[model samples]
Target: MQKRPNKISRSRRKNSAQTIFTRFMLIVAFFILWIGGIGVRLVHLQINQHEWLAEQAQDQRRNQVKSKQLRGTIYDRTERALAMSVQAKSLFADPAEIEDVEGTAKKVAAVLKLKPSDVFNQLTKAKVENKRFVYLARKLDEDAAEKINDALKNTDLRKFDEPRFAGLHWKEEQKRSYPQKTLAAQVVGFSNAEDVGSAGIEQSQEGLLHGAVIKKWQDRDRLGRVYDETELEEDERELPKDVVLTISNSIQYKTEQALEAGVKASNAKSGMAIVLDPKTGEILAMANYPTFDPNRFNEVAPESLTNRAVQSMYSPGSVFKLITYAAALQENMIKPDGEIDCRKGFIEVGGHRFNDPHATKVMSYGDAFAVSSNYAAIKTALGLGKDRFYNYALEFGFGSPTGIELPAEARGQIRPPGTWFGDSLASMSIGYELNVTALQAASAYA
Candidate 1:
């Protein structure tokens, strides 16, 4: 019995040791497989996926911008520059390179005098969408751009070797500049940042003054520093044509100075003047009161933009008598020295009395004209009849546009004899029953 118990104890001890050894071997095998799997994954990523990840990182930091060629210049008759394009700086950003977007946006806005919330929203949207580029400001002034550069360098957040923030950057662009701020403002007009002409000659000659648009790309580094740059190279043929105006710069200056003084002295609401060559009818100078600078056209009153010399219409008053006298003289209705009676200083026509402020009675046509006698003019027009008068009126270019190559030219008003009242001819003769622009009256006599 004692020998059997000793054999059983030996067998149990042997079985327990075998179970313990098997358990240790299984644990070791599991650890080896886990480590080997990790190594395989590391190798695949390094060899196969490296290119794709690197491309992604590069794309995140890459910056590209569309650039345009400079526009053609505008010169006066003497080849003096009235409007030209100058190089200006524009601010931009890349959200992918920017960290702490909210904080960066606040600083940018404060320095740029922009709305903080606007900057934050734009930056946040770009970051969420993984966009590479965004514009912060366009066509910044020299002082303004310098202020941004100074702020970046002097800020507390700047490091010794790097900028205070990422994504803030600047690029060159063309800005329209006018040397003569208010001179010929209405005639010269102005353009917008899109290189589009909005008013005056700028609007009319858009095809000639606006240049071509070309794409230009510039590469930037992670800290928002440009490493590679490209520029727009254009020959004269590819650029827009420079415009030469008929206006004389010296004449324009003198005309504006005189007009401004006259308007101020007269205390008039507004006024305009145009000097034209009688021989060729070429306009030398056109001026208007209450003018605005093209550089700051946005701040002017809307009424001031009107080119009143061609647009506004008013009755020529006593000026129409010249037309009547010439028409009567042409048809042989009266001679320049014919006799007319204006002793009463007033005459009755269709129960309405018309008075001559300064009248001479029983005078020659010459004397009547010299005195501006209303009676003599009325009688002559009646003798000619409305039919002949209407023909002469149309011949004088009344009731028609002058075709001045200017915007909004007004066509003066004239009624046919068929539409006239019994006294219409009389009123027309005295310059009362018709509308005429200043240009029309001057043209009639010219």
Candidate 2:
């Protein structure tokens, strides 16, 4: 009751109250701004970039699995598989994840019949280079890979609790198998470890055989458990079409056998033969000497792997006389029964002298053909002259490839009349000077 407060004391008291209120407001404002900043960040991440964040998480959770990307089955006209793709296993390892590198190399080498030193060197190199994928073995048989997996499991090399093994891993791959072995080796050809067509039909029909790789989306957990699988778009998914050839199995086998015998009996360096349907002109069988097995193509020499029927060019010999006879007969230059002076199996043309196997003073045109008379053929070609001779050969598909469905086909060489030497016509009449393939001659005869 007695002490009335001084102005200075009241002022100090009000100032202190004001200071406390200001500090309290500042703290509340600071907290509000901080919380609002956090909320804005959450909105941006959740709404604006939701798909991007989801993809990032998915990338971490799922593993991209690449398949063997095998080619389609190659079947004969009868649906017998000549070249086929089969399921097999390939072994690989992550250098970073591999523990006991030397041990892994030795153990795997023993099972795969690979040199331990080679395996060890490769693994060590991969580790030093920080490589994630290294193939230990490729295109192994299913039973063979299982043996390796068994070995790894028994030694506790594969850690079951881990996301992936810290050791060897197995991948399913497609391997090319030739069921008929060397039966149609050159015809079917072969593919490499990567399933690439190397020769023959395999190389020619690579587009249809080697289908596109399908990248499928699979949601897998850390333990490799499948959560969900997304269907690939129809456009993205490619199923290789099976290739059916016009080759017949029975005819092919017989042709090969006969050709083999003929080659051996003749004691020739090499030979090639083709069997075709005269009406259809479809290749029933194509055989090559010293043929190789498509299954073991690597072990054979390159020459054996050649498809000689359409690739090798040689003189037609007496076979080409058919063209000369046809041209002469069609032009009515000589009748089948007309007599011609063979000059005792020798004839002179353009300062060149030619001899025949059958020496006859005078013989009918048909008799001259039956005896394969070189003199008769030369005279016949000269009678047709350079222009008619060249035209007849051209009409028979000479000087060009037959355009048969095969790889590395060869087009025979033939000079036009403008380029022909004086003796060129004579030589060509007997299937010389010009080049031709076994298939070409066969087709002409057909």
- TM-score winner: 2
lDDT of 2 at 125: 98
Model 2 Cα lDDT, one tens digit per residue, 340-392: 88867687777888877595678898888888999888888888899988988
The lDDT for every candidate, in the order shown, is: 0.81, 0.84
Worst 10 residues of 2 by lDDT: 156-165
**Native-structure RMSD, model 2:** 5.8
Best by lDDT: 2
Question: What is the Å distance of residue 260 in model 2 from its true position?
Answer: 1.2
Give the clashing residue pairs of candidate 1, or none. none
| lDDT (Cα, tens digit) per residue for candidate 1, span 237-292 | 45678888878899999999999899989999898888788888777888888789
